[model samples]
Target: MPAAHAATPIVIRDIRLEGLQRIEASTLFSYLPVKRGDTFDDDKASEIIRKLYATGFFNDVKVSTEGDVLVVQVAERAAIGSIDFAGIHEFDKDALTKALNSVGLSPGRYYDKALIDKSEQELKRQYLTRGYYAAEVTTTISPLDRNRVGILFSVTEGPSAKIRQVNFIGNHVFSDGTLRDEMQESTPNWFSWYTKNDLYTKDKLTGDLENVRNYYLNRGYLEFNIESTQVQLSPDKKDMYLTLTVHEGQPYTISGIRLAGNLLDREAELNGLVKIKAGDRFSAEKLQATTKAIVDKLGEYGYAFATVNAVPQIDQEHHKVDLTLNVDPSRRVYVRRVNIEGNTKTRDEVVRREMRQLESSWFDSNRLSLSKDRINRLGYFTNVDITTVPVEGTQDQVDIDVKLEEKPTGTLSLGLGYGSGEGPIISAGISQDNVFGSGTSLALNVNTSTTYRTLTVTQVDPYFTIDGIKRITDVYYRTTEPLYYSSTTDTSFRIISMGVDTKFGIPFSEADMVYFGLGLEQDRLDIDSTTPQSYKDYVADFGRVSNEVPLTLGWSRDNRDSVLIPSRGYYLNTSAKYGTPITGTTFYKMDAQAQYYYSFARGFILGLNFQGGYGNGLDGKPFPIFENYYAGGIGSVRGYESGSLGPRDTSTGDPIGGSKMIVGNIEMTFPLPGTGYDRTLRVFSFMDGGNVWGTEGESTGANGLRYSYGLGLEWISPIGPLKISYALPLIRHANDKYQKFQFQIGTSF
Candidate 1:
């Protein structure tokens, strides 16, 4: 055997396109991805030939040259005759047709034998997912008239398999019920396969194994491992069992931690940053993460090149491990570059301007990290990742690379609203969540009603520091008119205020966060006496003070994923307002919402939402209008007006300040038929029951719960999420309140 030597021995002078039946020669030339007179090596020649053949316009391709002139020859492929699908018990022909078309294998298009073969294999695999392990798919191409061929897919969907048993092997610490609960498959009932309960696949088995591993790891089993998993089949080939073997190794605890090498910060001082304490579970991965954290901490002090290695000295006899973190102190690397990526629709400047951390400086690891979090808080991205790329030439330089996944941040929403007595009203709102790349949000709300026009601007930084703190700020200038049947106080008012609030988030655990903040707000309140003295005195007790200062304290704990459509978790927000004549009375308020959603294999989703609010004027100044709770709307208790279901004045019959509100909605949202796999359009049915009433000591004729039931449409669009509903009051109760068939619409920002 002789070895080939590398050389540039061929130069492509003139390129003449030879294939010309169906495809244009110009298109064929472009397929070369290289021009005439370009030199060609074996790698390049092979690549060009492979690309041209990949176009599927040719069954054969050959490249030859004459006097430095390159010639490309291609044999066009045959056209498709018909795609015949059969034995489609699980899916229709049109379904399979669309699936094939997605991969460019439709009947009207040119036929690629390789693609058809791949599709056949995929179809067989797809059947396997549905528990048809013995399903067989055979593709045969028969020539038709005019060199056309028909793709015939012959299928045999064997008997569907049911999980006869699910066993947990090598699980000694936890009960078998725990492991079984994590499994997607269970012992089959009679005809469970027909009921879509017994369908199991390999993916499910693997996922269950991972679930088991995570369960143990999160519970302090640091060295837990999945040894193996096996599936056993019964004699009938219809019943199966999944057995997973796991090795729950000795659980080791942290004996002690030793610091070695370098400490950019004080050794005794930096010790506080280590979250993993002595006697804690010895997690190898968390140890590594802790080491990286140490390095990042050092970088915060301008020690950018710090290297930290956390080594555990195992004492298997005592089931304990001693940790040693060795550090390497290198010269602080300057940030030579900072780059932004994945802003496909948004302009670069938008994100760049939002960045408090700049480029071309001694890379402050703290600032760089804060910058990443600041960008993420913009809510314009699904994900934001910041990487430090080491420069090849200099040890003192590193480039910052920012990659963002842009998400829908702006919403164009239409609002078709109805009142308890008033007719339907159409309005629109357009809002931007990420504005000027500074992580600010801007919103404009307009209603068909003559008095409701508003604009709001808000900004927030999720990472206020290198230690992962979050800061949020909002300023709103809003003006709205109260649609009062009786013209008490002229029925309208313009109120504006500039207030700043800040909160500090304390991470108690992965799933828990404790937050506290303070706000100082100065509000100007004007009481217009356009109504009779009885109406004015009933609300304010006298002439209301025009302006006042309220010191506000707030606290909240959030464990939720989607704010708009939460499936599970709890959210709690409470605040106290005090100052001046209101200081002693505790102007307290609380808001809490809980949601639970469950989805089964049949595509059924059972969900419930509960929200409650309470407020007090604290010393009976007729609780502030803004502090009062308003209910009876689409987002609240449907089949009611936006703000017409609360407490009311006796003389003027206007909704006065309510002290408390409690609302609950049980919803079942399911995908609409004929929708694509994205399932963006959904239909939901709901029963909403809630009420707004007076507090323990207030006077405004606040009463009992108003009830409603409704059907709604939810659409997930590129602009935002859209929701519209038509609700009918179940307890209109002619005795007291306002109740009418209400229609409403909304969208998420």
Candidate 2:
């Protein structure tokens, strides 16, 4: 704007402001450089215009002098009244709004055309990442009252582009199929809809390229190179094809590996950590493992910042390479502080008590790793991480930070189930693994069925003593009516049992615990005319009611990676109980179970379980029939009726009980066809073999080992874990009762 006094400068007596709406005149005056009683000229007028425009509050600014008084006129920009999205199914509206807000396009902010265009581009980019190659974004601005505007982002997201094929030009040692297997992206397949492997994404392609490079490098292709990659989109923009050009150079062998660094006078121990030796095929994985092992070894000795580098010496003509592991122990640091984070509900002491590395102690990576594993085993947290951060201005000091993500530690369950042999069963349980954030546990469970009923209450204190011993107390009452015989006769016969026990667990190692307990138990037998002869004889010999004091000893070890969906590790549990003749019959019983899980490939796990039990009476007395072990059920052997594989009553032909039992299962679990690598839902194939044998009962036709093979589905549902299986019994005996289908909830095999 031209000043009225353009020829010369003028002395302003006052300043006048215009176009004030949402913004006040005082606010504008604070930003103005030309104030009241100040000299004004053409240069000052130009400066005033620039200053007002730079504030972003005004869309237009005009500065002029009226009779030596400066006049500043402005047209303020419209504030955003509202922001809306249309046809946004792929993204949440709030999420898109947040994204736009990141780029200065939200309600209450001055609307800018440049920011609108920028936000449109950003939205398009977001859709493109999700394979929406034909997505279009447009912005519309509508004037509202009070000089405000509403923005509408209209998105047209077309069909996603699918990967048609992935081709490799020059891979000699491996076929195109093998190379494609190494990449996550692939042509449409049966499982493509779920895994989205057929979706063409730039980030996934980049990662696939890196994986291909590593595949060749790890297989002794020292000079492997990806010459180029071409991603072609079809004319319709609905299909994508990727072609990678590669040069797989000749494979090289490792000539030798030597350690050359400060090994802390433990050269021999460090050398043993090297997995690759002389005359071996070159492998990048082994080299990386070797370096990490050396670094970890030094970390165990308080070298928290240790470094190990594998410097390779390549020979082209000889096709050989030599590796030199250079280790650097930078500094020996001690932990200055141990910081715990993200334990919102759990007490700090509950977590701190699990740490193996204490404050003001030497940093030991081994101890830190063990601490993480222990916390995970607590089953109270969903995620746990431990990291070491160097303390500022300290050469030999560091801080250990423990980060945790807590999960729901309480479970309230109500289950309704039906067993072919046992009839309708109802169960309910309420348990808390971390009660009151004190690392204590309490649980109550009740189950009732036509043939059996039980109630149990348990409490545990994990830190009963300062020495890491655990105390457990349990009280239970149970009643059972042998299903097989109950159906054969109209008479009623039942066994009632009640017990109270207390145990102490002492940790022998990181993975092992030993338990000792003593308990008082009472058992009563109610029999009628049609009662099984075995039970009648037992009562005749030992009386109808018995009370005893029992002593129990047990050992357990668990190191599974995940308790919910374990992919690797082993678990073992063994227990023995001896009934003393304090008031009744004396007997001995032992049970052992061992489980092993191995993950051989991605999303595939192999599990093996073995169980055995043996019981006998002491002092030449017969073992109590009520105390006999029963097998052939969901947890024992599938495809057979519960407790139906044991010796039977000689006359009634009903399975009575057994003094010895053995069971084994081999199962392979993999991802469900459409679930990808989700562990929550899976399918498994299993072979089960088991039986129950009695040493003194009448031999029935179902007394031998039974075998079955089956397929099962496992789902971690909202209520609990559910397992359903359909089995075909093998070598069926004429008298053996078979149940081809079985299912259970809130249990794991």
Candidate 3:
């Protein structure tokens, strides 16, 4: 032990502090046990020294008495000038800095040797949690002038400890492979590098154990329990082994079920929501689901704080369990206010108008969910969250807060590409779905290619009136150079068209809508000797120019869960267009389409689509060739060239489209492997079967159905939706052009 610096017993008139660079004299005095007009003793001096040192702001302390006055001095600790790290590739610098800050060791803070040691230990512990068992951290403090210092934490993060084996013991009812498959962490495999499944984590192990428990519980093992979990690391710390022991009790069957507690006089309705029944095996999952359903039912009746719990009665000898649902319906609550937040760019009214639930109304979970869905369907936000807050003074009044994160709703796209059919193509478009945050849309597009050129402008007002009437207007101009495949030589001709259309949509229900429109169009065909016979005949009958005024009626119903990436629900659309003979060339067109989606599991979806169209001339006039349907290419039949599926001219094998069209598509979409729950990227396998027929000329019936199967990838990139596909045709004609590989960027299908 070192000799005592002083053993003083004296009365201090005033205490003076010295050697403090940043700390104030008053701060030292406040921490000192002995103050002015107090007696100073050895014990007080020792206590004062200990407290000051404990503050972690001082390096040394000295006390002395000078002529009945005490003098206290302290050498303040050096402030950290900078904190840097070396060889830290596993963790980011910012994260390490934050971790050091949590341990009171950061730049601009007073440095202490003890704190540095603590921070190093914490850093090493963090690395261990991340499977970096061989990680080493060495901290260096460099002294500088002006009582400042710099900290350098050098880290050597070795290879992560990979899981070599995972074994489950004492599970008699299930195989070891089955239990291991339920765990997120697994032994090294082909996908281990990407999925990081070979790395062991305590949190992951905990979750895996819970999942194992739930698995047994859901299978009628009412008394299942996990005994212990052991993790063994190799001597080199480069590999790990995990073993889990579980006790799965005998399976039990359900003997009876009963409902108790407050039912709000809706016993029959609540009972109908119970999915579990007598004579079935006892299932924890079913019981929990039934409880949730009962609670949701109560919520529909304004019982916002409802609770339902399933209490089980076990018969040990009989191996049977009886369940009783206990329900408690707290006081019904009413919404006092609805608050919208986090929408910096969008106007409040834009979101508020989509909400179905109103303030001052009884709380309804269904309406609240619908409101959230409607806002999500607008496609203006990335995330939407709704939370209920109880009122401070009232028990039956609550406030709803709708929080949202806005996303970009305006798109500016430019595309340039070359294809065999279209030659060199250049396209550009600018669209705004939420124009000026008014919930209106405007778009303008221009496309130029060797075979076709077009310019279009469109505008839509979703809420043109207070009654939810939608209005859409469109104007377009197009020119096409038909390049028909000729047996001897290539032939071509030119056609120009311009048109304008306006439509009004009336909402009949939340999901159904009816639309009526009128359009005026004119077409002029330039005939040449090289032109195909189909085009020449049409020009000779209808002249070089033809005019038409068309009336259109359409009805659509959309109940999809999401408009951008729907996984459930269905959509249907039907429309008819009739060209008035009194105005110009007479023709009529009818089209009907339906799409359905089914979600089989998390991140798995099945989609089915069907479309049919019929077109013919009125008053015995032949239907205009331009008014025919062309099916093929990326959006139609994937394995064939664009517009190459229908009837072909005998002399020049150019496709003439068709008056009747039918197409059906079935697709299964799943998340990309190793991508977890990321919905932005997906992979899908599809089967497409469809064909176009022409009643105006030659008829190709059921035999014309072209079937194709392929796998495709869809990515929601920053610019737009992109699709890449590789397909093979199952049924094809000899002359049908095959395009096995196709892709489209900056477009949606």
Candidate 4:
């Protein structure tokens, strides 16, 4: 230790620094308050030492006088050479590294004993948040060569604490079960392992508390109060119990509801939006909804910064509340610019063209929301967010920033499976929905099975023109040989077909499109002595080789909220294809289908589908066997074999697809019990009724309406979409084929 000096100033001729390895001498000079030419004193020397120590780059700093010169010495702290973690099983290594880096405890940084202790506490705190009440984190420092050190954190994370019981007191209007049902966190059950709702955390408890409060407030408990909540932990710290005590006040009713404040002379319009009325029970949910609606309505009129406040005046004597809505139309703003960001793969124009909200236009909340939805529907991004920022110089101008996280839009599918009908199948396909980020689609598919082999190539240009017209071209070759499962004799023949089709879609509206198609097809049949009589007859009538030209017209409308997982929407499609008499084979086919989806609750959906098709020979000839419609599969009636629902060949007992088809399905879809809001996985219950009839038979009758009820699971896996179902037939004929369990990979239904 240096001795204390007198309170006298001295003139310094020179100054020197010592004990610097990595730090520069100039760096030390910059922090010193005393200069060589300036007078030095004890106070100045003290300031120099204090500032150097505050830099956190030194372990010790001292200043002393040597003759007419001032000498400063600093012992630099050891730099961290490496940081390692041991016994860390609960959290990911990358995540922990980031957390430690955020607290200034990373490799290549100077080591501080105080910061090391703080970092340990932070690690333990994180474990606590994850319900690891018995977690222990201890840090060790190992000396290394050349004034460097290594930090090692050993963590012991015990079992996560589980909630054993939850009790609510002072609840008269609703039972404890009812209140518990409203909470997202709960005690252990069959699904606790997946949902983790049994685990207790401060954030979960806070959210649960809010939910409880909202339940009472919405039910007209005007003065509901949660007095206290106690969370008791077991002595072993593996179990927890929670108790919530509350005071349930008297229920209240609405005496009067009025709209005050700036209505902008639209009092009638605003009043119509109010959901509350006099004599109705006071509901906090309804009040908040009404307030938000009014604000949104104002936003539609260019008042983007509007505010609506619901002020409740309570009459204690009568147990009634009068509601007043106060609106503030802050300013009418216009958008100055629309900025796009975070698109590393997709082109700017590809995303910008979908925007309905243009720069320099008055801000419309509906248009902005529609723009975001349009971007989402493109399926190019996993997440999309939009934020509005007021312009720096003006109050009436704002900028819109669209931030997106892009996802892979290309898919490669490879599948190998065995089916009862198709002995073994192998399929491979590659598709690019956003080809080169130009928003074009190209796909190539090849499927080979014992019964059928197909090769197809398709390309689509969604923006064939600047007006949003779409063009699609397809070329395919397919060969099919029916296999006889019940007969010992090989009586089946092979049919080969090659076709090319081109279609153009013209947009009629935002959700509607009209399509026109033209195609040319050639078919050839190979028959032998043991061929089926139906095939022989067809070959005799239509010849072995036939050519046809088909003209198609179609109209479709889609308003689905999401193409992948639609919660609410409707889809309608109708198409007709006619084989002109000018061509070889003459036939006409007409089909119409409609589907509707409704989200009845947060995670529940109801879907209805109906489809019908009719086809016949135009010039009094038999309908083409190759163009017949088949039903009863995963996409149709699940309880029956694929393509085995129509008329059957007498001797072969094989399904010969019919010319008329009718199908209807009703389904209710909900999230899995423990999946939360994950839409990629869902379980659904469905009832399907469908059948096919020959051209000579009736289109509809109770006898032919095959019905099946089943439970199905759908998962959008990383490889592709997968569907599995278990079904039971409601009405079955003696000869009807039953396929109770069915599954398919790389397809969507």
Candidate 5:
């Protein structure tokens, strides 16, 4: 717009003032679009006036031009002085503010009568949503100090509506029992105490109707539809009626199935993998499976670039369907980089350590699946999704990116527990999942629990060498107050141990590994009273008496998909603890554990765990007490206290000697909270057979094989896991056994 001039040929012949009851012309014209010496048109001038009026500051605006001199006038609406509420007890101030603003009625702003007129309607709408059908609302505006206006809205919220009747208008074929099962509003059930259906919510009703539609559609009701729903409120405004209309379409069956492209000679094999079959119910899920199976089968043949599609040919007249699967095989691709993403704390080496499919490895679906499972078993990530990102300039080379969300992989725990024989127990531990920015794991533990005291620390470095060999080390100080079950008296007998171990791994196969380690151990013993004479004689006669050092060697093979839920694989770990007692005795200890898991048809997870430990004099001095084996607990042999359930001295009736303990537990895990996809809450029935006792000249007896049958519950929680189990002893071995129930943190599994 041009600037104002002394003689701009502008003049005002007449002035038409609008409803200007308060605002001045100068204040109003300051925001006007048109000024002196500016050309104006009706559309332009009207738009300017409309813009000002839309601000809610003015009720009307008027502009007149005489001889090119313009005159503008306006009437400003009163600003809201304050807001007051009454008869509204349930809703607080925040709720009122949101409710009022829905219709544009708010304080500290100009009052627009049109918005105020809609405020009552909006308030009543809010009440209806909350099941208050008969609620009434009124609004009044009053002048306040400083030319401001106050808004007072009076409301009677009335009573919350209760469901009187809920009926489905049009649902057939499926029985009321079946349909009602999908509804959240259960008429009456034994579990009503847990989930009360008496309370009616529109959201729940709508969701039920949606479920009804899905049920029909998934059962080949392609034309299934929900017609309408009506929610009726009673005159007293305390009762509700919900009526639903649904159309269940004709059911269809799979009439035929066909596969196309890139199929190997194992067409029958591919067909078997396809879950969809002729005469089966026409299900979208089955059709999707057919496509995925074709793609996956081709993947096994190195056809990574395979496309599978399931096209449905619907036979409406015959109420049947046919599935057509088409597969296209492109050039086989290989992984350029098996990379990890979204790991802020975990190191690349840690993730890489678990991958079966390495960088530059062929994209074998089997290997990729195995690798994905390996990474998941690390327990670092809550979820791990492997997707192929195409590489530029090469159709046969792709990058495998693992997208993941890390859970609490490491734990810092403090626990207090007790048993009938042992008093109170306390333990503390710290562990790092991704140590040194690599995928190594390390843990340090200290405990003064039961009759044992330990200060132990261990660490694993998966890629200690540039070529991917792993290393592990452990150093510890452990002491035990020894006892003999057969001895007439128990004495305070203890041995101290300090050891360091290191191991290296060899890649046996893509899915297999073998490892070896060298260890150095030292031991000493202090006997406050006469121990078993046999034990003292062996230590004194053989050079294996207290005080000596020994060298050790070991081997292991691990091939489990998940330590928690292994579908197929065997894990074997064994180590030899050999040496003469550092100061008091000479002894050698050996321990080994072998476990296997297999998942069969359905959700059955079969697990077999075998563990055994023993100490020997090795033609030298007797094995030290600290080097002896003691078990009988949840972690070793359940049904007895730690260090209990062993051979006792004949005179004192106290367990004595560094002997052996054997354990084997076979369990089958079943689903709990059963139908959901998530196994966050699960229950399993298991049979545990194990016992602990002293070894006699490399011989293990029946006394160390007591058995138990039990069931367990597991809950995966944010803080940690919660596990509860009850076991009944199938074989009663002794009288000092504990009650068969056990409850512990979830992560222990």
Candidate 6:
């Protein structure tokens, strides 16, 4: 209202709205405080203007009265027409627009300059989190027809800031390098490009600080504290310097361990669960573990809501701490129901059969844990979560809810690999781990290379019987070409074999299974001048073709935490096969493998594997040459050609696989740089040693084991699992064939 209008009171006959383009007259009247035949004053005019402006429909408003007729004029804010981005390589434009919408700035909504400024700051903050310290965001606004405006966010994403140096001060016990090694963030290293540990971000810095805290606390520094941290950016904004000041408190040792509270009359047994003892260094990790163990123990006895608290009694003078564990087993509850959710594709019975915990039974944490592991091992779901929900108004009953996030169980894979010896290997496979959600599996695979070609079809019924027995059937055809032959060789030697096998798996325990199978195969050899003498001798001895009826027995146990990226646990498998004399040649072969994995830290894992094989004559019949075992490959000893180890023909220099094989590997894996703790991608350093030996026929001068060490990369890519290794042979022999670089897709070691 103007001063003139404020001084006079008039009776308004009508209220008029001017400068109305898209707004309606009735809409303006609804906001008017005075109607027709009513007295109007400056107060009413001011009230009318405030209400209209509150709607955010108008940018400017003026009120006046001309001879009892109040007139209102306003300029509305322009509605957003379109939002765009330029020079935005760091983020998707659509994502940016959605982000801006969260801050009340997007198309089809009225535009506000203050909100635009806030959006710009948010955009800049996003860049900073990604190490783009020099990033700049500028907004451009242009008018459009129909009271609308177009928004363009022009961004300049500069080079990412790198951590040039990291320093720790006020440290007496540990060196700067040692502390830095414990932190995730660090200065540039050889693997920095992949790990991005050299990049500095506030979140990563916070995590690094926590890591430092845990490191000290785990080493008995009960009073350790970080005084301060400072991050400095270079003038060019391309480099960063990090400094952490810390107080290293005196170390403390455990004086005593006391157990209190309800122990269910099992104090002695509960006390046995304590991992800490007198005179041992005080460790936060051990304290937490002890508490968790107590709680888990209580849970195993139907106490689903158990609590354990450890209170430390400090004796500062003696540098000792006495720990008191307070246990509370809240309630012994029975499961009212076991509800399964998020398994849209899989049948309920499939998951139910795997569960050891049942409805209407006392809650057992051990059974629940086993159920979770069993579900995970199925590989049908990506994530599984089981939580006990207390029943409303009930103290002794709870519902067990199993939540699952399903993943695609079908895979169509195409693989391409190159080896100095194999020469362009290609393979394709299609498989469904959970076919039609029935918990069965079916697969067809074809692999071809210069040395061999194979086609196989397999089917597996995991629940062949209600007792969890498994049945597997396989039909396969394989052809092997002469290994040392050139592509130009017009005449080459080849061997073809076809077989069908059926196996039944009987579960002896949760992690162990025993398998028995029968197979029949016929091998035919086509010989040429380039064939190795061993192959010719075998053909002549077996009359160019041979049939075998083999019986196999196998045992396997797997308790790994994860099949794809195992961090802990062990796996053992052994198989033995004998050709029945009633049908074909009489021979026996056996193979065994043992693998173990241990995780030292969040992203560091150690894996060890050993494999051995043996084949010999039975009932005076020699072991068939076609059934010999070959070594020296990515899965065996790196830096050596695949299937190129062991005995070689004295004439053609071609590898004649041996009847005995041994291989071992020691590997350490860590998260790939820049990938955080994601285990899908990792880097590993490994040492491998293995050799093959002949007992009956041909032999090569290289008789000892070949050892190699190298670094490798493993990635679960869109196509499949990919592995690349750059190995250097440590002990090379005169006849050893070295392959320094090797890579394969759709395979695992």
Give the TM-score (vs. native) of candidate 3. 0.82
> 5 or 6, which is superior by TM-score?
6
Clashing residue pairs in candidate 2 are: none
Q: Rank the candidates by lDDT, best first.
A: 2, 6, 4, 3, 5, 1
Query: Candidate 4 has what TM-score?
Result: 0.87
Question: How much is the lDDT of residue 241 in candidate 6?
Answer: 97
> Who is ahead in TM-score, 1 or 6?
6
lDDT of each: 0.66, 0.87, 0.84, 0.84, 0.67, 0.86
Clashing pairs in 4: none
Better of 1 and 3 by TM-score: 3
CA error at residue 400 for candidate 4, angstroms: 3.8
* Per-model TM-score on C-alpha atoms: 0.56, 0.85, 0.82, 0.87, 0.65, 0.86
Best by TM-score: 4
Model 5, 367-400: lDDT tens digits are 7787788787677889999987779998789898
Ranking, TM-score, top scorer first: 4, 6, 2, 3, 5, 1
Judging by TM-score, tell me the better candidate of 2 and 6: 6
lDDT of 6 by residue, 1-749 (tens): 34226576777787777888777888877776678888777677778878888888998888877777777888988898998899989787777777787788778888888888999998998888778999999899999999999999899999999899999999999999878877878888876787778888889889889989999999899889999999999999999999999999899999998999999999998999999899999999988998998888898899999999888899989889999988899989999999999999999999999999999899999999999988988999999999999999999999999999999999898878764556678989999999999999999999898878999999999999999889999999999874643323354777799999999999989889999999888887788886777778777776677788889999999988877778999999999998764444578899999999999987999999999999987777667877888887788898888777788877766777888999999999998765667688999999999988886445564478889999999998866677889899998777777788888765556
Q: Deviation in angstroms for 235 in model 5?
A: 11
Q: What does candidate 2 score on TM?
A: 0.85
TM-score of 1: 0.56
- In candidate 3, which residue pairs clash? none
Task: Name the candidate that leads on lDDT.
Answer: 2
Q: Candidate 6, which ten residues in sequence have the lowest lDDT sum? A: 482-491
lDDT of 2 by residue, 228-322 (tens): 99999998889998999999999999998999888889999999999999999999988899889988888899999999988999999999999
What C-alpha lDDT, on a 0 to 100 scale, does residue 562 get in candidate 1? Answer: 50
Q: How much is the lDDT of residue 198 in candidate 5? A: 39
- Candidate with the larger lDDT of 1 and 2: 2
Output the lDDT of residue 112, model 4.
82
